[model samples]
Target: MVIPILMEGKSKYLSSLLVIILLAASSLAVHAQEKPRIFVSTDIGGTDPDDFQSMIHLLMYADRFKIEGLVSTSFQTGRKQNILDMIDLYEKDLPKLKKHSKGFPDPASLRNICKQGAIAWAPYKGFRKSTEGSEWLISCAKKSVTQPLWVLVWGGIEDVAQALHDAPEIKKNIRVYWVGGPNKKWGVNAYDYIAENHPDLWMIECNASYRGWFMESESPKDITAEAYYPNYIKGRGEMGKDFIHYYKGHIKMGDTPSLAYLMHGDPEDPQGQSWGGSFTPITRSSKTIFNRNSTVADTVATYGVIEWRFNGPKINVPSDSTVFTLSIGGQHWPGYYISEGTYAVRYSPKQIEVGEYVTISSITELNGQKGTYVSKAPWPGKPEPNDFKLEQHWYGDKPDQELFLGQQQGAKTVSKHRKAFLMDWAKRWEWLE
Candidate 1:
């Protein structure tokens, strides 16, 4: 009886030990399932207000995504000093609306908008950092181990291009989503640069000046290519209204006119009724430019022109063909708007967490629909359209939403930590779909 009793006690202890081990393992698995990490690289005030809008969106969605770092690049725009100061001020005071609004920025609520700028943007002056953009990107990529690193580029590819040229590891691991050219024919340097050095890296191109504006009409319902004016936008309430006010207030100078600013739909413009988001499907393809031999005589092996074809169709494209656009006022803007189009890739948060891998399924379709076929995968299932929420997301009730908007809009009546705390609170949404 004594021996039997001793055996039973020993068995119970072993079972408890097993339970502890299993629980520890389960905890580890859950911890490992955290969200995919993201990095944003932008040229603040570079092109249009689109990058500005993206910045706002990033601030909003800061919860669902882990923004390991933010690198604001400078190219084709202003030097780093002016750009940084402008961005610093902008971040300090992004105008927004109030009055019973949902997730929007309001001017009257949260007052000060000071946060640390990207490390490279320091010296608080307008000088460019000696550290190359690619080096920074490559360093960030190598440093991140907990999750995959995504590099979102909102300007010229010079920095990323430089980085890929310098670091092989960056070319292998980092995924790049850039908003720029392959305009119809000009500024093909990035494409040429990639072909020569970093061909393996994945890229998502958001074509430049892709969308335009629309004019106001009695029938606001007209089928239009431009941005839907005050009415449709107002539906988003104070936030949307404030945005339009800002756009109208600022866009009346330089190269164009009031009529050109007529609310036209442009992919690059942020003021359209049809707001652009991540899941809007895109197409990706190799960007290649073929030129004719410039020499008076074509040498047999040296200067002969090589004809190029896309798919199987014979394009009337010239080897020496050049693109030129003439404005209505007879202004000649010389160059081509060569675009390689944009590509869409889908990957799920869960799969990324479990497998530590994400895959690019395919480019978007020609009809502006998502692709029917995904080329490569260990995809958990088939590809489906993704409606992305703000990155680090915290879904709140109407009251919470109102509060959040109030904080964003600078109401002067709320907490200073509203934005920062809101960002912190967003981490709770990692498991949310």
Candidate 2:
């Protein structure tokens, strides 16, 4: 069977083409394994300091993150005048952002780049309703060529829930980065928001059953809700100084008769001492549908499966109601182990149902309290038992823009926490690396 085949110019060219095709396929494989695309959906004008700070960070990584679009949700609900006023304040103060932080973009410049001719800067076509917003987001996700979209929803996940229900096609295209819910203390509004409409879609409750909170205790002075501020903020420029002078009347801290929140770094939780990063994970299933419901009036989708009512370990809190610690789980041997389905969560002391999987949608914690975690738990959007109350609320001084701004200026103090937050931020920018 040894016949000498004569190789022509065409044969040589075909071999070269095959090599190029293989190289292209290998390059695509590498690209497919890259980081997720990030789209930030913030509840703009909600007066939440965390969302505002998060926005600054989002903008800082604008180039690295795909940032398909921005949507503003849950602004002050009643009164058109109040809404407009709040929007104006939000818009005006944007220019002042850079004055507070070197990492943040100049508000005016950011506006120019992102804002349309409207008071609000949502860029999706059509009326900027929540349903429409979610639809557009879904479209953005489906259309992304680089990676699966990670929706960094730093507000109510209602719109996204709606979008998922409306566009089943979008289910496979995105993963939600939810930042809401007070664990068991709060109902699954985000989950219910979609579940009612899309019965088949999975619900990754960020509340109940999910061991979604972590705790850390720092010095009394430094341990305020504004703990992460010092890691990111820098000096405000000229415009920021002007805004501070002019808009002094609008800033108010708590119910104080005259005083605003004191803007200073706490003496106890000094800039560089104890550093930590904390967040809770919600639960959803990979097998869930993409779109559950879509209409001219509303286009939403519900996608993903979440194991139901699965409970996990509970953290122990002190009678003082301030300090917290983890009920240490027996460390497992390196190799052999049974899964949760194969075993049960030892929740006998707390009366938590062992085998029930719970959904976690969001987590919140206060500044002063100590937080502890039962190290082994599924990440955001997985279910666990509703046993111990997650560490919630930051019991500290008045929350003010200035306090956050001050923290931003001194963000370097909590470098470890800052790095962790930035690592999540880095995930949004995986396409770059």
- Find the 10 residues in a row with the least total lDDT in model 2: 254-263
TM-scores, each model vs. reference: 0.42, 0.41
How well is each residue in 1-433 modelled by candidate 2, as lDDT tens digits? 2333445666888999999999999999987444335555555454443333334334434333344556655434311232233334445444444344334333343332231111221111112244545666767767847465656554456566657656767766555434333311111323433434443432223221111111223322332324322322212322222222222312211111000001112212211132221122222222212111112232111112211112222334321121111122332101001233111111111111122212112212211112121211122212323211222211111112232222121112222243344334334323221
Candidate 2: residue 383 lDDT (0-100): 36
Total clashes in model 2, counting residue pairs 3 or more apart in sequence or in different chains: 73
Q: What is the lDDT of residue 141 in candidate 2?
A: 67
Model 1 collision count? 60
Cα displacement (angstroms), candidate 1, residue 185, comes to: 5.8
- Tell me the lDDT of candidate 2: 0.32
